[model samples]
Target: MAEVAILGGGCFWCTEAVYLEVKGVTKVESGYTGGAQPNPTYEQVCTGETGHAEVVRLEFDPAQISYRDLLVIFFTIHDPTTLNRQGNDVGTQYRSVIFYETPEQEATARQVIAEMAHVWDAPIVTELAPAAPFYKAEDYHQNYFAQHPLQGYCAFVVAPKVAKFRKTYADKLKT
Candidate 1:
């Protein structure tokens, strides 16, 4: 009934767009975390100096979608096996990570990763870390994909990820 899930899976734009469509997600904030810098900017994160991964802070109603369901959708939308990269975007900031809010969430993330890893050929490299401070991204970056779907990056990269998420989590969508 109550929980928070923070995840970093590739570009925050792609992850934000996908989670926005999930029914239980009451709020989705694109941000930076697991880094050293306080209030790191998108540019700073892009530079990878903050030691923080670009992340999304999700506020969801667990009654509608369990944290476990969020983990499944996250795994589906991003390539968790790759290290510090998702497709063409490469950097430490782009690393796949899950910031668990509790011991239960941590366990669930690990269990899901283990199960899904067996289902896929590649080893899962998604890092499971304790939740840390999350600095919200720039205003324009908040909803990048939906705001700029025609943008080259969005058209070629984010759209496909969103479409895949929609198909995969069809039952869990917000409608």
Candidate 2:
């Protein structure tokens, strides 16, 4: 047992898929957070006005995987340099964010962002916010890619993201 972390890189489905493959990750729940509304539906969230970014909350063992490692995979899998967008998905709801579960997590997130700034040319726009009420997304959103890899969005978007994660973070993955 360790700590929990919440991150939004774009679609929760994609983030959930990648984290689930990590060895220390005990659970990954697709959910909504950083929003004005409470328990917003998926339809409401996609509108980009819910104030909530689609996020995946992960419960993991720190002894096996560090939050720092998770951030590395996160930055690699998606464009944190981009503001309010991941490829075609555009909106504040798609912005890169890390909702920290503790003070230590918050501090670590800030430190990682600073280090990444030198690693990448563009500035990282990832927000380090305190963890809020996490509203679990509909059941249909869970394990989306694993269950529906043949779906168009899963093929075009999630497949590449997962492959990139597997390729770039091979040593960190759960084999």
Q: Clashes in each model (backbone N, CA, C under 3 Å)?
A: 2, 0
Question: What's the C-alpha lDDT at position 117 in model 1?
Answer: 88
Stretches of candidate 1 exceeding 4 Å from the true structure = none
Each model's lDDT comes to 0.91, 0.91
**Candidate 2, after superposition: displacement of residue 174 in Å?**
1.2
Clashes by residue pair, model 1: 35-51, 35-52
Q: How well does each candidate superpose onto the true structure, as a TM-score? A: 0.97, 0.97
Q: Residue 63, candidate 2: how far off, in angstroms?
A: 1.1
